[model samples]
Target: MTETLRARLARVGQSYAPHEHRPLAGYVAAMGAFGALAASLAAAAKVTGKPAPERPSLGDVALLSIATHKLSRLIAKDSVTSPLRAPFTRYTEPAGAAELNEEVRDHHSSLKHGIGELITCPFCLAVWVATGLTGGLVLAPRLTRLAATALTATAVSDFLQMAYDISKHAAEGD
Candidate 1:
């Protein structure tokens, strides 16, 4: 049944984008997994008798936003975290100070290609990161805030360091 469904999806993908691999089935699978995770998290909260907050605070949202940005970049592009994405992406070059440029590796399996794309794209991964962070905010607010604070601080430090470098370069030019 699964094979039949996959074949049908492949045909649809081919019709939609004859020249490119669309991986519609793979995308569907990824979306299903995300939905499952969210459902399970909700179930867990219910089973544990932990009520989700009525509304998250503005400060918490801001912290998670910054943390999510930092974490998504770290996972998707950081040189140190490349190993996590190595299976799906081919190293191309150094993108920045501690980041890498990579191209998704093509494979016969659309699932692998789909996952590779997700793991290599920071913008794509941010949704997953933000979801997890939001879940954490409900389940463990204190720990979540602590971790978010650290990530936010690191992001600010990176920006400051870049600004300092630019200032030094300008001074040297003068």
Candidate 2:
């Protein structure tokens, strides 16, 4: 018996990433984890009087988490939707898988758009990294939370707007 298309797509996972390529979901998760760690370190350093090593911040974690969620949704959509589309449906035995294939395709399409929206812009990633650096700098005391606050706010808002734009793109089939 042949394996179903959904099974095949699900197996693809995010593992399809090239050896040199950064897996979007993995990167997003790492960013979130990194941010959480950094924030903990910052709070720790503040309490212990130990010098805070550079790290991510709460805002960073929030952004990273959002990105991770987006990518995860993408993977799920693709895995689920592809099996429902045509050609794949033809492979179904006894009954046609057309409905399944169509559903998969629609969701997969949405996810693909989400992926592009999540990571397509170089500036967003740049700002995200910069925000990390700025968060680290906040430990200096001279740097002040005011500056960090501003940057964090910018990062969050910018990402939110871009995310919205990406959704629009996906909805329009771009």
Which structure among the candidates has the greatest TM-score? 1
lDDT of 1 at 75: 97
Task: Please give, for residues 20-109, the per-residue lDDT of candidate 1 as tens digits.
Answer: 988788788889988988888788888878898888889998999999999999999999999999998999999877999999898888
Scored by lDDT, model 1 comes in at: 0.90
lDDT at position 55, candidate 1 = 87
Candidate 2, after superposition: displacement of residue 129 in Å? 3.1
Which candidate leads in lDDT? Answer: 1
Superposed Cα deviation of residue 53, candidate 2 (Å): 19
lDDT score for candidate 2 against the true structure: 0.45
RMSD of each: 1.3, 15.9
lDDT of 2 by residue, 4-23 (tens): 54344344543675343333
* Model 2 ranges with Cα > 4 A deviation: 1-25, 48-122, 143-174
